[model samples]
Structure formats: C-alpha cells, structure tokens
Target chain A: MAPSDSDAIFSALADPTRRAILSLIGEHEELTAGEIAAHFDSLGRTAVSSHLRILRLAGLVAERRDGRFRHYSVTPTPADAVVAFLTSVYQNSLEQLASAVQGAATSEDTPAGRVEERSA
Target chain B: MGELILNNELRLEACPSELFALFGQGDAAVGWLFGSEAPLLRPGSLVRLALPLGGLARSPGTARVLSCQPNRRIDLMHETPWAGRVVCRFDPLDSGGTRLRVRVTIDDVEVARLGAELGLLGGYETGWWEVPLGLLISLSGPAGILGRSTANCAQLAVEEINADGGVMGRAVRLVVGDDATDPGVGAIAMRRLCRTPGLAAVIGMHSSATYAVTAPMAVAKGIPYLYTPTSEPTAEHPLLVRFGETPMDQLHRALPLMAAQTGGSRWFLAGNDYSWPRAVGATARAVIERMDGHVAGEGYLPLGSQNFEPLLAAIQRSGVDHVVSSFVGQDHVGFQRDFAASGLRDSIRTFAPLMDDAVVEHLGESGEGTWNALGYFVALDTSENREFLRRYSDRFGSCSPPVSAAAEGVYEAIHTWARSCRAGGGVEPTALLSGLRRSRFNGPRRCTLGGSLESLLLGEATRSGVRVLDELPAATQAS
Candidate 1:
C-alpha cells in the first residue's frame, strides 16, 4: 500500500538507522546496496535491505537497479513538500489568530488585542 | 566594561530576503522565533517577548522595533528586564546563500544579569542561532594526475559559489567521477552521474577523444553538459555547450606570431590521433600556408605510444624549423621528455597549441623555449588573475598541482554554469542553455564571455609563462 505523504515522511524519518542511511545517501550521488550495507559492519545485508525497502516505500528514497546492485538516492521533493505544508499551516493559523484578535473589543488600559501578561 | 556586546554570523542556504522575511516580517517571524503569535513589525511596533520558563519564574519583556529595512537589517530595542538592542543584519552571499549576522549590545547590564539569574538565557538556549544545509552540485573529469588539476579548480569554483551563498540559496555539493581519459570509462561515469537524482548539471571532460564518444551519449540522455578542456567547439548537440577555446581560436591567435619568431616558412606537425589534434593540425596547416609557410612533415601518434624516436628522426631529417604539437595530458609530458632527450629542441623550436603548466612542469628545462597558446595562465599579471592565483594557492597551498588553462577552463565552466543556472532559474537543459548563452564574466588574463562560447582574450606561453597578446575581434569570433 502507498503511504500518505506526511505519514511516509514521518515513518521514513522515525528510524535512526534510516535517517543515517538517508544522510549517507545525501552526502553521495548514489550508494549501492552493498556500499550502504558496508557502512554497518555488524548488520547483515538482508537487514539493511529491509530498511531500504521501507525507505523506498515511504518515497523518501528512490532506487535504481544495475546488474546485481540496487543503488539508492534521497528524493528531497518530499522534504520540500513537508516544508511547504508547514509554512502553509503557520500562515493560515497566524492569519486566523490575527483577525480574531483584531475583531475582539478592547478592555482595560493595557489594550484588549495585545496578549495579557500573566505574572508569576 | 562599557556596554558588553555579543556577535555571531551564520552562513545559511537561503536568500537574504527569504531569511529576513522569516525573521523580520509578519507571522513568519513569530512562528520561527517564539512559535507564538506576534504583530507585524513597524518602526515603533511593540513586541512582547514571552520567555518560556523552564521550571523557573518567567520574565516577560516588552521590546520596541527600532528600524526595519527589508532584506537588509532589523533593530529591536528592549524596554523591560533584558534591555538591549538586538540588531539583525542580512547580507546576500555570492553562492545565492545568506550571511545572517546578529549583534546584541546590552546597555542595561544589570537587567541582563537579572535575566541570567532567572535562567532566561541559559535554560532557554535563545542565544544560539541555526544555519540551514548547503545544496549539492556535481563534476566529472580525468581522475588522476591528468584530470585532478581541473577537478581541483572545479571544486574551488564551487567553494567560491558556496561562500557567496551558492546558486539560488542552495549549498553546492561536488560529485566527481574519474574518466581515466578513456571513452568507455567516461561513458560509464556519465551514466552513473545521469542516474544521480537532483544533479543540476555535468561539467569537465579533459580529453577530446573521450568527449567525442561521451558528448553524443550525454546529448542522447538530454543532460546539460558543459565541455571543458576539450577544444573542439562544434555546437551540433542542443544540450552541449563548449567553454574552452577551440583549436581554431588558439591557432589563429598564436600561429602567426610563432611563425614570425621562428623566421622560417617550413613547419612540421605532430599530435595524438584524436578529433581535437586533427582539427588543430588542419587549422594550423591552413594558417601556416596563408603566412607563406609550407608543411615539411606531419605525423599522428596513437595514444600510449612512447616511442617517438622514428617521428623525431623524421622531423629532424625534414629540415622543418617549427614543429607544431597537439599531444595532451600525460602523453604530452612523455613526448616532450622524449623530444628533449632526442636533442630536437636544440635545432627545432616546437609550437604546441595545447601545452599547459602541467606539461611545462613535467618538461622543466625541456619546455624552456617552447611556445603554447591558451586562454588563461597562472603567471598573468592582472589583478583578477592574481586574486584567482592567491585564492587557489591559499586553499590548496604550494604543493598543489600547477594551474593550467585547461584547469582554469574547468573553473570558468562551473562559474558560467552557476550563473546560467541562476539566470535560467533552474537546471533543465533548455533553461541552462538559455542561461549559458546569456552568461558573462571577466576571467583571468582579461578573458571574458558576453554571450555564446567565444573567449575574447588569447595568450601565448613563453619561457616566463603565458603572455596575453592577441584577442580576436567580436566580429571575427561571430563569423
């Protein structure tokens, strides 16, 4: 099943091992499965492959097969999408908050639109 | 002490305006800084800094905006507990990145001390700022001694771009591949680089023979490829652009002078069997005949052929006063050493259109009196060239490879590509081509390209080093 964009990005970024793999791929153009696996000496190739499969499914990483090796590279479009989504969220929420504050009636000399200070 | 000041600068992979907008504009500034609602910053707008107390008493302060210069500077004057003037200056970097500087001068030291006592600065960690990651760019060339010099310069160009803020506010990452001066290897490297996702463009192919095979392949793949060091400037492929001086350009600029210096009408030709050398030889022959010089002998050596004894003997017997050579890379070094050992330089002064610093360094005393033509030289006395040499030497140091025209071509290619990338606003082939056509820069040795791939300045390599002499007129270059 194809995961949703936010779910996929969060899932892909959830694992420390996957994040490390993504960082390694980011530093290079593309890293073969064997080359990527070589970085984790203690882990078996199959274990690393499973993690790569998860990342590929999440759309955070793209894979190209050549001969016996499958090369993986980070697709930054998803990260860009995440940034756009966050920016939109911030913009909309702030706009709504600003209008709500402006629409309210004034109270006390401190001004009603201004945030009230709570003394400790 | 008077007013204690704190200053910090960060190189961020973002445009100055974009960074300033995030910090000084409406909503975005508040969201970025405090993750809460804040009013639009006007000259006298009051901002409430609601310090999030970490298991301590909160100290809320009212800070008044002193000034707001869009994409430039924003100054804030605090009135309550932590009284200080927080000045944020945003400067655009050359690499399309932003250099954001923040300076805080505490006028009321006691207030700052009280805020510190309340664990506002230490616990909240508001003193530290963040810088985003740099973007990535890739390069390919002959990997070893043959290509490393060009690769080094390509890397240097990227560094300068990144320092300036990178292309379009993104940091540049250099992806390098070794062509090994072989066509087959170059093909594989090109394929590997093509498969690389987010690759902006490809630059650097040192050998014409390698380029001849790889250019068509890269064209077929629709990659925006900039041909550097290889002098065959056929713009047949839509996606391929030539940045190096063509053999015709070099020969036309330097041949007449070389013929005059030799004071003879008889000449011989020798070069590696390749598209560039063959083109150069043809152009030389035409130019020499035009100057009333006749070709006495000509020989084409297959690459990796060390035995130049027969060829040298033929030139020696032909009574040719000038020997025009087109040998490239390590082969050129080997041939020059052999030519010097054969006692050819004693009688026949050689004219090589492509000989560079690496060849000269390898030839040492042998290359002493030889003549060469190129677009750039490390020994150029101009301020721009001197600055280039200074940066290169400062970065790579004394033991670094000798700077050559080919290497400088690689450097120029990257800068041109970056500029075009900026102008075109993207790295797509058509965008880059359009941008490349519009790119211009004042390069080393007063060399500049306004539009298209024509280099206005050309130079001759002497015993002292490359001396800028002839520059083809714009009309002649256009023709």
Candidate 2:
C-alpha cells in the first residue's frame, strides 16, 4: 500500500468517535448508521453519519444499500494494510540495527579478530 | 485527537470465570499472550513482559495494573518505550463461551517511536553475553528539553563500549525508563528498571526531587545506581555513586571569581524550591558571608514556574548586582529569558550552576553574558573531548541536540561504570561498587569516583554557545 493510504487509515483511526463507530460496526456482521448511532449517548445521528462518511473515505468502512436502507461494515483490507505497514517497519528497524552492529564489529581499529586474539 | 483506541475481541471456548482464572495464573497468561514469563497480576504490581519483535529480538515492556477485578476487568498503564492504557473486559456469551474484549488506547506518535527502539533491540544476537544497564532520565515533562541529548549520550557510550569489546567481554545493552520529571513517575520508572532481568546499574539525570525518591529503591534492589547531575551531598552508600558536582563544589569555585570579575559583593539567591536549589542557596549564603559579602535577597519558586515578574521585581528592589539562580531545565530557560527581557541583564550578572550547552542553546540570544560553572563544557579544546564529540555527532548526526554537562555526565558515568566492571572483573553489584570507588576516567573531564572534581570550568554564554572563560582551581583535593 502507498504511504498516503496508510496515513489515511491512521488519520481515520486517530478519532475516538470514529474508532468507536468502527468497533461498533465490527462487533456484528453489519449495522445500519442508526444502529451505530444508538450506542453513543451524546452523539447525534448527523454526527454519526459524518463519522461514517469519514471512515468510508478512509476505506475503513464499506457502505451497502438495500431497499432504501444503508448497512455499514468494516473493510478488513485497510486494517490489514495498517498491520502490514507496522510489521514491515519493525522488520526494517531490526535489520538496520543488526547491520550497524556488524559494521562496528568489522571496524579496523577494534576488529572482531583483535577480540579473538585478546581472548586467546 | 485525544488518544487512538484499538479494540479487539476474541471468543474463547472457556467460560468467563474460567477464562479469567487463567490471567491470574501468571506465566500461563503471559506465555499465552507474549510467549514470555511474568509475575502474578495484582493491583499496583509491576508487570515486566518480554514482547518479541518478529523473532529477531525481545522488547521489554513494563506496565502497572491500575485496577484489577476478579473475572471481569484488568486495567493497565504502560510506562516505558511508550505510554498507553489497556483495558480487558470479560463477558459471558449466550453459547457459554467468553467474549474477551481488549481495548488499547495510545498516542500514535509514541507507537512510531517504539518501532525505532524495538529496531535497536532487534540487533541482539543470541548466545552473546549481555550486560543490561538502566537509564532513568526525563524524556517528558519539564526537564524533557535535556532528554534527547542525554539519551543520545548514553547510547553513544554504550556503542563505544561495545566497539571496544564491551564490559568484561560482555556486550552492554541499555534499558531506558522515562521518569517524566515527576517523583511518583520516577518511582514507577525505578521499579521497572529494578525489575529488568540482568540489570547491572541505573544512570539517572533527572531532578534531585526524583533522585530522593528513586535512590532508596535502587539501593533496596542492590543495583549500582550512578546519579549524573548536580545535587546536594547525601549520606554516602556503597552502591550509590554520584558523578556530578555538589552545590558546594560548584559555588565555592564560582562565587569568588564571579564576585571578583563583576566587583559586586551584594548577591541575590534564586532557585526552584527543591533540595538541590535549597542546598545551593544555603552554600551561596555561607560563601558570601565568609567573603564579607552580603546576600541582598533570596527566593525559591516552585518548579515549572514561568512567571518570574515578582521575583525579578524583588531582585531589582534588593539592589543586588549579582544573582545565583539554580532553576533547572525549562524553568532555567524561562527565568533567564524573563530576566533578560526585564532589562536587568545590563546590571546583574547571573551565575547558574545547572546551566549547560542545551539550556544555553535554548536561551539563544537571551543566554548571552550569563555565567555558569560546570565540570565539562562543549567548548573544551582537548583531544579526548573532540573525539567524544566526533563519535557523538557521527552516531546521532550533527543536527542532534548539543552535548551539555548533563549529557556529558551520563556519557562519562557509563564509561566509568564499564571501567569499574573491568576493574572488579565482573558485573556483580558488590564487584561494581568496589570497582566504582576506585574508577577513574580521562575523558572530556577528568573524574575520580568519591572525590572532588579535578577542576571546574567557568563559562560565559554567548549567542553561538558558552565560551570558556577560565579554569578555576579544584575546590578540594582528591581524597
């Protein structure tokens, strides 16, 4: 995935209300906008609709229409993309650390050969 | 915008109560989750878990239970590497299974930084002898301005030691805990550091307020703790070694020169209301009296005080030509900026013992002409110091925060501890302690453990950085 797409997912995940909305939708197979709005006491339907719109734009949620009603469900693809990005970043960091240590070990002034000589 | 919360739920075959019992089983639950061993989870218990990073390395995570309810909920707050809260909820399902909900609320920025630290730990090669050292410094809060440079310095020292075949032929690894500049937080960080497996020593660079709380904890755990900042003299303990100068060590050498240079015998004492500052104020009063100088005024503001108008007004009214201010970190920066803006910069010469390159840079133009005395200055023209700076810049980039006395102090503290380990021929606590008493380093600053500093350098801050004015004589001979 592109960095911007992952950024969009993170930006979408940054909001508490949107996260709650995503969690609510994720709990069941699917939920209409009204059903998700019912879980939050302070949030109105309009606010819920706006949050769902943002989640949709971020590709975190998918909306389907059937018989004049809309159902919302989480798009696992985006969440998996986030996990993949984090995993790859972690792996890259490890590789960098390993190579840096190896570089230090190979330096001429204090080489691993010298260490072996001293130990002998 | 407040915090990012991630919620995950899993349906297990066991019942709610039965599943809850597994959490209290300690190693079983830890092994199940992190594939590591852990102590029993209880309220206020420190939980140290080795979180594996892609089978390459294990990142140690320390969390404390805020509250735990039997078979229902367990809430935890993560301390090190990142800051976050976790809540586990157990609910009974209709089909007799349990729906376990885990909600983690964290700051995204911390998660990104955690990835970097995990990468550093990932380079650990299996079967290599490793000496884990704890570095408890303020990565956040008021003293956070000095955090990056201090951390960088510690990292540089560890790398240098590794490049030189490590301590006692064992590679050194640093485990960091952020004190956040709060005593309570420092206690948590100290507990986490003490609990780390194979932890050899702890090097602290936070405020003395935090030191008072953490020092006893380190002593109780029998770990060698080397505190690396200016502080008041405490009762000497074998395991606890202080590398920085004391209030008397700084003021005795600095006050006379400052008095002679400025030709002012009347002085005003200002500092944060803490043990170190109070000790500095007391020492300044005595030294001034001994020299037949009068302490024209004195005041102690609480830490993190930004408004220095009242203090400035008092300093002006007291008719003192020189002031000895001991405010630390951001408080130091704020006080200096306010003093300069008050137009008092023309008449009053300020002597702050705690000021360093980082704080001077933070002051920028306002730091001009301010006098400071410390054991190490960035402007020291010595081969040892130049090499130290070169290594630091090479590792952390030249754009990194300047190495100040506080930063250099920790760098020297690590090398000194490594020397002690070499002297004792092991990394055991008693061995390290005995070795520390006789440890000497010919680094940027010449230091002997449990002895007076070889010399204290007086510096005057300029727009670029602090310029070394003169090397004052050592206050006391090496014992």
Best by TM-score: 2
lDDT of 1 by residue, B1-479 (tens): 45545454455556777656555233432332322223556665445433221012221234556778878887876433234566778787787766655565654233232222211111111111211111111111111333435656877988998898877777776655444354544444455455555666777555776676667767777776777664766647767766666666667656777777778788899998878888888988988987888999999987545578899899999998888898865457667778888888888878787677655654556676777666666765678888888888898655455677778877777777778878888667677777766777666733455324444444544544555555554224645
Q: Across residues B6-61, which tens digit of lDDT does each residue of candidate 2 receive?
A: 55455555676875665533342233232222344556454543333212223333
Clashing pairs in model 2, backbone N/Cα/C closer than 3 A:
none
Best by lDDT: 2
Instruction: Report each candidate's C-alpha RMSD, comma-separated, in the order given.
Output: 22.3, 21.4
* TM-scores, each model vs. reference: 0.55, 0.62
Model 2 docking grade: incorrect
Model 1 chain B: worst 10 consecutive residues (lDDT sum): B119-128
lDDT of model 1 at position B399: 40
Q: What is the TM-score of chain A alone in each candidate?
A: 0.62, 0.66
Interface RMSD of each: 19.1, 21.9
